[model samples]
Target chain A: MNNVLVFPMIVPILAAMLLLFFRSNTAVQRWGSVGAMTVVFGTSVWILQQVMLHGILRLDFGEWLPPFGITFVADSFAMLLVTVSSLVTVLCLVYAAFAKDEKRESFFMYPFALLLAAGVNGSFLTGDLFNLFVCFEVMLLASYVLMTLGGEKKQLTEGIKYILINILSSWLFLLGIAYLYGTLGTLNMAHLSVRIAEAGQPPLLTTISMLFLVVFSLKAGLVLYFWLPGSYSTLPAAISALFAALLTKVGVYALFRTFTLLFYHEPSLTHKVIGYMAAATMIGGSIGALAHRDVRKIASYNVVIAIGFILVGLASFNIEAIQGSIYYLIHDILIKGLLFLLVGTIIHLTGKTRFDQESGLIANYPLFGWLFFIMILSLGGIPPFSGFAGKLFIGEGAIGAGHYGLTAIAFLSSLFVLYSLLRVFLIMFWGESSILSKNQIPLSKGMLAPLVALGIITTGLGLGMDYLSPYVSEAAHVLMNPDVYIEGALHNE
Target chain B: METIIILLVGVLVSTATYLLLSKNLIRVVLGTAILSHAIHLLLMTMGGLKMGSVPILGDQVDTYTDALPQALILTAIVISFAVTAFFLVLVYRTYQSTGSDNLYELKGPQDE
Candidate 1:
C-alpha cells in the first residue's frame, strides 16, 4: 500500500529528472514520457487494488504526525481519479507522439507533460489545503508551458491571458489558505474539518469558504470560464484535448473536497449558490457551444457544460448526489479526453478546424470518422455510453433530493449539449463529400491506436457501472462521513 | 504598527485593482505583481505582527513570532515571483507577436 501510494508522485519526478539529462535526445524524451506515464498507469492499478482490499491508504510524508506534515490519502475516490488521469495522460502522450508537428520534441513537451501528471496525482492524493494549492500551481505552470509550446502568434496572445487569469486565481487561493490556516490553525484537511465543526460556522468561515469557492470556480471554468475558449482554442489539438480533459476536473475535485470536508454545514447557502451557478454555467456554455463553428471551441464549451452538471451534483449535497457527482466526474474525464483526442485527430487529418472549411471527413477517413461519431454521441449523453450513465445518476440524484426544477434543468441542458454535438458531427462527417480533397487523411497508427483504446474504455465504463458503483458509493460515503478523514489525519497525533 | 501595515495593504490592493481594470497589458501585469505583494503582507499580518522579534526561536526572546504564516507567506512570495516572471515573459511575447500592448486589441476568434 505504501509503495502504491508513493508510485504516482515518485515516477513522474524521477522521469522528469532523467529527461532533463537526456534533453538533447528527442526520441529518448518521447519514450521517456511514455514510459513514465505507463508506470503511473501501472501504479494506479496497484493502488486501486490496495484501495479495494483495504479501506484507504494514508501516507504521512517524512513520518511527521498529523496537522504538522503533508499527508497523502488514497481512498476509492482519489484512486479512481488517479486511474482516469493516468489513462488519459498515457493515451494523450501516445497521440501527441504522432499527432504533434515535428516541433513538439524541441519544446520540452515531454517534461512538462510529466509535470502535469505529477500535479494531477498530487492534487488527487494530498490531504492538506496548502499542499493542494502547491499542486494547483504545479499543474498551472505546466499548462502555461503547454499552451505556448508552439510559440505561434495566436498561441502567445491567448497563452498570456490564460496565464494571467490562472496566476490571479492562485493568489486568491493563497489568500484563502491564509484565512483558513489563521482561523483554524491547522493545514491538515481532516483536522481542519473538525476545527471548522468545532468553530461552529462563524461569519469568517463563510467568507473564507466563499473565497475558496470563487478561486476554484475560476479554475473549474464555471461562469467565469471565458478564458477557456480563447486559451484552449489557441493551443495545438492534442494539448487542447489534454487540457480540456483533466484541468477543469481538478478544480471540480477541489470544490468537492472543500464543500464536503470543510463547508458541509451550510448546505442551504453553499449548495444553493453552487446550484444556481451550475445552471447558469450550463446555459451559457451550451449557447457558446452552439454559436462556435470551430471544433476546439465547441469541445471547450462542452467542458463548461460538464462542469455545470458536476456542480449540480455537488449542490444536491446528499449521499446519492455526492456519489452521482463522483461518478459523473469519472465519466466526464474519460469521455471528454476521448472527444478532445478524436477532434485532434480530425484536425491532424484535415488540417482544418472549422466546419465551414472541411467537409465529408467520414468519407475521407472512415475509421477516424466513426470513432469520432461514437465519442461525440457519448459526449452528448446518448444511451449505452459513459455520458448517459453519469447524467442518469446525477439526474436521478437531483430528483431523489427533491430538486425537481434542477432535475428538469439538467435534462434540458443535456439535450442542448446533444444538439450542439450532433450539429458538429453532422457537419463534419455526414455532409457532402465534394468539399474534401483526396488527401488520403494520413492516419498514424500511434495516434489512432490510443483513440480507439480510449473509445472502447469509455464504452466499457457504461457497461461496467455495476462493478464501479460500489467504489463510487464508498467514495461518497467517505466524503459524506467526514469522521473517517478527521480520524485518519489526527490519528496518533 | 499592525494597523499601518493593514492600511498599506488596503492601499496596494486598491491601486492594483485600478491598474487591473486598465486596458494596457503592462498595467495588468504590474497590477498582479502589486496585488500579490499585498496578499503576502495580508497573510503575514494575519499571523499577528511583532516588532523586533524574529519568527525563529532564539536564546534571548521567550515569545517567537508565529512561524507558520511566515513559512506560508515565504512560499507564496516565491511562487508569486515565479508566476510574475512567467507573466512578464508572456506579455513580452504577446507584445512581440501582436505588435501592441493593449489587451483590447488582442481579441480572440470569438471577437472575429
Candidate 2:
C-alpha cells in the first residue's frame, strides 16, 4: 500500500493534538514538537528516497479511486519540498525553544506550529486542488494564531492587514477553483491537467490561470510583496524564520505546480506574465530593501528579492532554469533562516533592532559577525556558497532565453542585496561598540546549534553541489513533464 | 434563473469592491465576507443551477444534481466562515488596542 504517503501530514496533526493535551507544559510541548518534526522529517526523507528510486507514488483516500476521491501524491518535487519543510520546522522549533517568546509559547505556539507544518505538508502532497484550498486554510489559520499570538499593539495592527489580504486572496483562489471545476468537471489536479489539454487552452482557461497567478502571487509575496517586510519584522524571530523559509515558498510551490502541470499549453502567454511579475518583484524588492534601516526589515526585503530570483528562473521555462530555481530555492531557504536567526541574535544582544543607535556588534560577538559575513556572501551569490550555483544556472538560462535585460537586473539586484546586508554589517559590527544592553539575554548552545547547522548546510550545498545538482536536474525533468505526475497520481487501482 | 444569479454575483462583487475601497476596518471585513459569499454563489451557479432529483445512484436518478459542487461549496463556506470569524476577532482586537476602527490610524506610528 502507498499509505505511507500521508504520514508526513498525519504525524504533525497527531503531534499537534498531543501538544494540546500538555498546553501549559512548555517542556512537553517543545519536546513533543521536536519529536514530531523528527518523525515527519524522517518520513519525508524516506518518501523522497522512495519517490526518487520508484518514481511518483500515490495514495488514494477512502479507496474512491483517483478522480473521485481524495488523493495524496508524493512526486519528486512535492517530497523534496516536504523534506526541507520538515527540516525547517524542526530547526525552527529548536530555535523557538531558546527564543523565549514566552507569552506566545504559553498560548500554545508549539501546537500552532505543528498545525502549520501539517497544513503546509498537506498542501504540497495533496493531488486535489480543492484539498489544496482546505490545506491552505489550515495553514493560514495556524499562521493567524502564530502571527498574532503575542497580541501586542504592533502585532494586532500588522496581523489584521496580513489576515484581511490573505483572506481576500483565499476567496480569489476559491473562485479560480470553482471556475476550473465548472469547466473541467473535476477537482483532481491530474484530472484537471488532462481536461485542460483536451480543451485546448480556452479563453476561460486563461481567465482561470490569471486568477490562480494572482492568488499564488499574493501568497508568494511577489508583485504585492509590500505586506511581507512590515508584517515579518513585527514578529518574533523563530516564527519569522519559519515564515520566510516556508510560507511563501508554499505559494511558489503551488505556482510551480499549477503553471507547469495545468497551464503550460499557453506558456507564451502564461509564462510571460510570470516573467514580468518576476522582474517587477525583483526591482521592487531591492528598492524595498534599501528603503529600510532595521536589520530584520532589510533582510525581510531580501526575502522578496530572492522570490524574484526564483520566479525569474521559473519564468525562463527551461530545464536549466527550473533546475536553477529548485536548487536556489533550497539554498535561499537555509540562508534566510540563518539570516533571521543571526538578526535575532543581534536583537537579543543589543535589545534594539534598528541600526540607528546600535553599533560595533562584532566587537562584542565576533563569531556572529563572521557567520553573517558568510551568509551575506552566500546570499549575494558569491561562489562556493549555496546561492552561487542557482544564480549561475539562472543567469546562463536567462541568457539562453534572450532575456538579457532581466539577466542584468538579476545581477544588479544581487549587488544591491550585497550592499544592503553589508551596510547593516558595517553599522552593527564595525562601528563604535557600546556596552551591552542591561536586559541582554545570553545565547544558548541549543540555539547556536541551529544557526551553525544551517550555516553548514548552506555552505555544504555549494561545496557539495555535485550531489544536489543531479537531484535538482531530476526534479526539474520530472516537474517539467506533466505526464509522469498525471500517470502516477491517476494510477489504476 | 441563471441570468439573475449571474447578475446578482456581479452586484455582489461590485458591492464588495466598493466596500473594500474604504479605510474602515469593519468595512474591509464586510467586503471580504460579501466577496467570499459571491464566490461561493458563483461556484454554485457555474456548476449549473438545475432543478433535479436527489443525487443518488439509483435507476430513477437520471436527472439528479451534481453533488460535487455542493461538496465544494460546503468546504468553501466553512473556510470563509472561519475566515470571517477570525476577521471580526482581529477587528475587535484592533479596535480594543486603538480606540478606532480606521485603517488610516493603524497605518503607522505617525498616524497616532
Candidate 3:
C-alpha cells in the first residue's frame, strides 16, 4: 500500500490534464511536460530503488484488497521499464519542442503524448486483465489522436488501417478475457495464475492464450505487424520517435508478462509458437527494413527486428535468456529513441525522409551523423555497444536452452539488419550531398542537449554493464520465478 | 437456449469477419461494430444466462445474477462507442482528403 506506487502514473495524468488546459501556450505546455516527465523519471527511479530495497510495491485502488480491487504492482521489471521510458519521454518531449510541426504543437499533441505515456505506465504496472484492456484503450486512444493530429491525408489513410487492425485485435482480446473469466471466474492476474495452477492447464486455456498472443503481437509489431510499417512511417518524426521507442515494446512487455505469469503450463505448445514467431519476426522485420527505401520506414521495420529479438528471449523461457531479453528491451528502447530523434532532426532539416533522396548534410552536421552512427551500430548489436549485451545473453542462453536453430536465426537475421541499417546510413549521410547540402537548419541547443545526454547515457550503459547487470539480473530473476509475483500481488505482503 | 445463443454469436462473428475482410473501409467499420456486439453477447452468456434476483447482499436471495459481467460490458460498450465514433471521423477524413473509401485506394506505403 505504499503511496509511491500511485504517483508515477498519477504524475503524468495530472500533467496531461494541465497540458490540455494550456494547449494554446506552447511554452507552458512544453516546459510543463518536461517538468512532469522529469518528475516521472525521478519517481520511477525512486520506485525502482524502493522495489530493490523492498520487494513488490503494490497500490490497490479504492482499498478493495487484492483479487477484488484493482492493483498496481511494481516489480523490478515494471519499475525498470518505467524508468527507461520516462527518461525517453523527457528526451522526446525536448525533441518534440523543436521538431514537432508548429501546427501539431498548437493542436494539443503534447498532452495526448503525455496521456499516451500515462497509458503505457498503467499497462506496465496493472495486476489484472480487465485493467490491462482499459490501459491499452487509453494508450491507443492517445496514440490515435497523436498520429492524426496533423490531419494529413497520409496520416488519416494509414491511421485508418492502424485503428481498424487494433480494434479487431482488441475485440479478440476481450473475447479471450471473457472466455478466461467464464472458465476461471477471476480477472485478477495473480488469482488467475493461482487458479490455473490448481486446475492444471485446460484445453480452453490454449485457445485463450493464442487470442492474447495475436492481440499483443499486433501491438508488438511481431510477424503479424503488417499495419506497423505503413502506420509508423507516416507519423511526424518527433511523435514517431516516441512511438518507435515505447509502443511496440508495450506489446512485447505484455507478451512477456502474461506468458510468463499465466501461460507457462504448456510451454512446449506456447513457447514453441513464440520461438518460431520470434525467428520469423526477426528475419521478416530485417528483410522488411531492407526492402524499404525510406529512412523512417527502415527504422520502423527495425522496430520489428527488436521485437523479434526480445521475443526470442521470452520464447526460450530460461533465466539467462529472459535476462538477456530484459537487457535487450532496455537497449532497444534507448537505441530506438536515439534513432528516431536523430533521424527526425535530419528529416526536420532536409524535409526528406527517403534515403535515396537525401545525403551529405552529414558533411555539415557532423554531430548528427556521428550520433546516428553510434545509434545505428548500437541498434545492430555491434560489440561493446548497448545492443550487444542483450544479443550475447539471449544468443548464449538460447543455445543453453538447446534452441540452436533459433540462435542461428537470431544471429543471421541480425547480420541482415546490420547490413540494411548500414546501407541506409551510408547513403543518407556519406554519399552525395542532398539538395539541402548548401543550407541547413541550425541544431537548437534544446535539441542538442537531450541528444548529447542520451548519447552519453547510451555509452555509459554500454560501458557500465558491471553496475547495471546486477539490477538487470535481479529483474530477470523476478521474471523467471512467477510464484514470488503471485504471492506479492495476492497476499499484500 | 444456451446452444442457440452460442450459435447466434458464431453467426454474428462469422458475418463480421467476412465484412472485415472486404476491401471497403465502411464494411470494416461495420464489421468491427458487429463484432463488438457479438462479443458483448458472448460476455453476457459467459456470465451464465440464469435469471436471478438482483445481487443485493443480506437480501436472502436464493440466487443472484453475476454483476461483474454487466459492469464490464458497460465499460466495453462505452469504449466501443468511442472507437466507432473515432473510426467514423477517421473514415470521413480519409474520404475528404484521400477521396476514396476503398481501403486499397487510400494510400499504399507498403510498396512505394
lDDT of 3 by residue, A370-430 (tens): 8888887787788678888899999989999899999998988888778887887788888
Q: Please report, in order, the local distance difference test score of every candidate based on alpha carbons.
A: 0.84, 0.88, 0.87
Relative to the real complex, the DockQ score for model 3 comes to 0.76
Worst 10 residues of 2 chain A by lDDT: A435-444
lDDT of 3 by residue, B1-112 (tens): 7689999999999999999999998999999999999999898888888778788876578888888888899999999999999998889888888778897777574456
Task: Give DockQ: model 2.
Answer: 0.79
Tens-digit lDDT track of model 2 for B1-112: 9889999999999999999989998889999999999999999987788768878778756787778888888988988888899889989988998888998888854421
Best by lDDT: 2
TM-score for all models, in order of appearance: 0.96, 0.97, 0.97
- Which candidate number has the best DockQ? 2
Which tens-of-lDDT digit does each residue in B70-110 have in candidate 1?
A: 88888888888888898898888888878999988877645
How would you encode candidate 1's per-residue C-alpha lDDT over A1-493 as one tens digit per residue?
4646878877897898789887678878878898899989998988887777777778888988677878888877888999989889888888788765668677688888899889989999998998898888888888888988878888888887788889889888988987777687788898899889998878889889999999999999977898988787777766777798889999999999999999988888888889989989998998998898888888888899999988889988888888878878988888888888777777766778886776777887788888888887787777787877678778888988788888887778888888887887788788787444554656778888988998898788877778888888888988899887676556733
Q: How close is candidate 3 to the true structure, as a TM-score?
A: 0.97
Over 4 Å off in model 2, which ranges?
A436-441
Q: Candidate 2 at residue A332, lDDT?
A: 80
Off by over 4 Å in 1: A1-4, A435-438, B51-62, B109-111
Task: Provide DockQ values for all models, in the order shown.
Answer: 0.69, 0.79, 0.76
